[model samples]
Target: MASKFQGFPGMDDILPGEIEKWQWVEERARAFFEAGGFKEIRTPILEPTELFVRSIGQSSDIVHKEMFSFKDRGERDMTMRPEMTASVARAVIERGLLTQAKSLRLYYVGPMFRAERPQAGRKRQFHQIGAEIINENEASDFDAIALVHGLLHYTGLKEFSLNLNDLGDEESRKKVKTALADYFEKEKNRLCKDCRWRLEKNVLRIFDCKIAECQPVIEKAPWEQFAPLGANFRKLTAKLADYGIPCKVNRRLVRGLDYYNGVVFEITASGLGAQNAVAGGGRYDNLYQDLGGAAVPCTGFSIGFERLLTAIQAQDEKAFEEIRTRRVYLAPLEDCAAVLNVVRETALRLREKGFRIEMSPGVFSLSQHLKKADKLGARYALIAGLDEVSRGKLVVKDLAKREQAEIEPEKITACFEQ
Candidate 1:
């Protein structure tokens, strides 16, 4: 095969049957975000290369190895965004959204790029539904946590848990890192290559290592040896516990991004195999200021759309039947011109009434057309032919009941409304 014809190795084509799950999840996310006071934001797929390096951290795997960076034809450095938070932070600051109000809550749903070995639930190009709340106080953090809890409950997952951790403010982190640095320096040779790299860049990230080889060494190693929380961080943790969020002192849970400074967390399921992290996020107090905006505090979380679907499907066999049955396929016979016109008009009216309709203009024979409707699992088939056109009426077939009825063309949209 030629290189031009081959898609990038880790990306996937979302075929017809696969997209319905995505649409269902997206609709649910929109409804949930709106109820939580988050407005939607759209960002460009391409970004300046420096955004990831400065915001995600140059030493992290995302920037150091996974980013799809290239020079445009004009020799300008550009990269496909590996995550949405940085771009969102830049937009919030550049637009001066914070100046208008004390806080900003925004959500985004889009594709993210990263070069990696594609595994189950892990793709080079994947989609994420993420939200960010900026310039908030203690109440905002609690709200963010509550929203995350509510979202998972709404998603209908029975076997998942949220892992929560509080990353202390910079002053306390400095004291902690100093202690851990001494410990890591002595056990430096025993640490994995990735952990060694993380030690110099962000020691907190070393706790997130998934390498089986590094597990034993990390298990015995004291997390407090590297970092400890300040008094303020402890108070925030206690407050979360008071709200019954079921948080624990998980020193091992840390975010991959460098911008996160407090309250890092993730959601996981048992059935997701080695890649158990299905969703995660944390607070980024310095992100706005680092991205050249005024100093502000923000926190949010993201759910991996594909991974969440995988877990749902694995747990429940019948979860997708409702989504797959939401269409009314329109099949027209003779009077190709007039029949097609009726089909188009009918579809528009039905769609306006909030019904999903599929059209088949090329199908000719009534038998073949009805079969098409059945194959698509259409709830109803709107049939129009020369006979119906002559009478100015439409034949509606209830594919589910195998019954037929005649209705005036103008009244077709009312059929599904019942």
Candidate 2:
């Protein structure tokens, strides 16, 4: 078997050194979500097939094309979640989280699998950070948008704009979608094959088509003209403006997911070719009740983590510093076993004190250890040998400045404070 330990096709690993940027973004997300009163929630990655089909709609692209479906040992059909909202809805209702609370605001961050093409950011198993606010006023929709805006701004994501549009309330959208059916009925040859199939199933997807030829046709289409804004929808948009967030009214902004019922919006950053939607979400006013739970209004958004990260890098190549695990390394002379043990113990103590420590695995020459420390990007190298160990002292050298100092071993912690 040719040493088959390769990663699954279309999936890749998050290598160790590349995690600093992810850590920074995740920390900011945790802080922002906490400040907004949205507690964290984790649901199982595997969900029943019916959960998605019932909520995301069978005709939608996610359900029809991208879902990773399989059968369990008991022969029950199951699917790895392609998106989080439906699973969150099912979990919320099944766990009865909504029964006791007047409102539930939850945020989730985890992997979602979809069998899509391997592109710059669209992976088969990619991660997403999302939030959901259920059982609240329509105002919560704007609040969700504001929260997303705050994260983007806080993370230094510039050169982006939020496209806001209401799918209209469920009833209003039905009226508009029904009214436009005949208008596009005879234009089958004019639209792309995907748009043609979607015309009857999800007319909104035609507007979101990425095909260059289909773009002009959808652009000229009259769908936006017919989608009217109701009072609730107008108030939501107004509230977003009052918060100092600039939003453009894009009538053609229909998300591919079926669960998005009321307001649908997406954030796009310029220069992210083909996969430009950095984040998106919408109001699923009836999704909770439709999934056999109490009627609750909910709205949320998700950051396409990989896509957004790529966009940031493309715009600013030097944004991320080189990855290094250690800020300091301790080197002990090759012949000094006892001194090596003391140095190792000191390194462990520094780590427990929240300092990043690095060292050679076994004893090595002083020159070799210093070379390794420099390569590993260690700023300070602490040296201890037979002489220092006997005296209970250490020789600290600054790699950048080529400066050295003799310090008592007990006072090593002071170096970090300085």
Candidate 3:
């Protein structure tokens, strides 16, 4: 039965069993980022609305249509972050991290808010695992791409495709925008109302349109003639090939955000239908300057944590078996005070030694404890009863093997170690 009162519509509670999967990925991501000279950064979820307005562009969908914005008690306009890049730039500049480091390699893991019509693998409040290389050269675009590639690969995704594109520098993008406006304008009658509005607003946004009616006019647009994947990108692809990183050029891969300039790319994994892109990003060299900072060359990418996990689960059935079955179920076989004390002490000690212990709040019968342990897929049950506690010993039962052994109080950790 559903609860009479439920959580707000796009928010979800990441309950216990499922939350372990999230933790595993988060741990792996932290290790990988730290190893690559990246440090973690956390910023508040709320920021001044103008931060996004200035950085993501006034014409972008995130600013105009999707942002969750409101005026605060003091009448200051604030917004729940719709994306991280703008917020990151705000943080790096505000905190003087800019002066502290010549080049900053930073990573973030957290939730982002966007008002979107929800669908499979897409959420209104979705989480992201992303990294940025600030003040690095153009080659850092490739570095950011390769980092995400290696990250997804590390998470055990065997089959995924990389689609690359070059949005060019500021000077080239204006030319592309003008050419796109002229071409999209000729076919204005064929465009959806949004595309027509976008044509005058930000012509590049037309490529982001998903309406079935606009495909014909958009497909024939002269993207290459106006903004061809330039020679510099040719060198990037060749370098990728030299290192055996597979990629294919996609002229239409211009990303949604407006601050993006220079190279842009998207990575797609199979099993996700139309929304197959699991991760995407590119260079946005001007974003810092847009948010009241010095000109900082930067490249970064963000992976949809939900979408990437779904892709991994679709291909592997036993995806989180190890995380599931490794916990020790602490069983107070008898509800006596002494037995409870022994079980509590043992649980704390095991947890201190880095073992996950599952201890129920209420006491259960011996048979009930065993059943609960099996139901949770617990590998072992640490049993303490009046008799065992009186003898200063405990019974460790291997739930899977149907085996039991007696160990002294001091030897319980060693028993589980075996």
Candidate 4:
């Protein structure tokens, strides 16, 4: 009665009933990326352990606490990729893709592993749809942000806000980091344990701490004094405004990653509560050189696939209805070989016409098959019985209309073409 095994905690299985939403989101993402001239790139799920440490920063949460790292048979350190930017950089450099083009526009859809406490939108193994634009300038930063805005809009997410921040250039970041470190050190006792540890190692990460005790100290940190807004940052905001994309400038928004510099952004949707960030990313100019490639400027963003679906479902229930309709159910009444062939061929032809077809197995009775079709939300059911097979005809029943008609095998697909 009880199962012998269970899935790992925080690792969820996307069951059949729920996976349609995922597919819908993924399809829209792929089409959007392709239209924007971003070629798809898939990197290995695992990378050298040092890659993350070097790119994501050792003091960051992903590298310090959340990474799934271990050694292999040869005792070489390896890690399951917690995020994709590092892996994408490694691929471009290793494959010499950058050598062939002046710039690279690539997108990826896959799972990222992070050993985080699972909540509604967070998971140990989660999927992301992201893109990277390498060897581009500050204008490309605007492009990257706008692209994410457009994609989220395409998903039919209505109530969302785009919060933008500039981490400043490298020199400004160094000054701010030092200022934050010194300021947080004085208030170290008042900070959380994690913030206390980050105070010395990577002080910017303290802003990422969501602990209530640390919020007061983080809010008072001297961000404007050290990293004052620059001209380019103003221009980015102006451009976004010009395009009619509403955004709020958040000086405290230093994204969790250390590699991000210049511009950073996060898009949060309403109704998802505290973990409402559906998408976020910014510029990482030095990542290429840091990972053993030529100096290149890159900007990109990743949409949390699960969170996007949640927001869509909450806002628009009808979005899922489109995928539920136009499905065909095939019911084979006779268990004989000839009837099976006819059922199989008919289903195959219908599928070729771009219809979702579900075939009933041999053991199901005609009544049971009809029940299954209804359960699947199919609009039409094609019943193939001995009499219909002998007459080279199949019974097409419009489940929604409660009507049935005998049509020749060739006319079966034509019945639903309208």
Using lDDT, give the best candidate's number.
Answer: 4
Provide the lDDT at 388 for model 4.
86
What TM-score should be assigned to candidate 4? 0.91
lDDT of each: 0.80, 0.81, 0.87, 0.89
- For 375-397, candidate 4 gives per-residue lDDT tens digits of 98888888988988998989998
lDDT of 3: 0.87
Ordered list by TM-score, greatest first: 3, 4, 1, 2
Q: Candidate 1, TM-score vs. the true structure?
A: 0.89
What lDDT score goes with residue 317 in model 1?
74
Task: Single out the weakest 10-residue window by summed lDDT for candidate 3.
Answer: 317-326
Kindly give the number of clashing pairs for every candidate: 4, 0, 0, 0
User: What root-mean-square deviation over C-alphas does model 3 reach?
Assistant: 2.5
Candidate maximizing TM-score: 3
Is 1 or 3 the stronger prediction by lDDT?
Answer: 3
Residue-wise C-alpha lDDT for candidate 2, range 1-418, written one tens digit per residue: 6865889877878875566678667777888899878899998999999999889888788887899999999999999999999988898899888777988889988999999987776899998999998888777888888888888877657778999877777777888777667666766678888888889787776776788777766776676577767777788778878878888988788888877877888999966887789999988888877788877888989988887777777777765542232368888874566887788778877776545677777878888999999887787899988887888788988887899988887777767666
Taking every candidate in turn, the Cα RMSD to the unseen true structure, in Å, is: 3.0, 3.4, 2.5, 2.6
The TM-scores, one per candidate, come to 0.89, 0.86, 0.92, 0.91
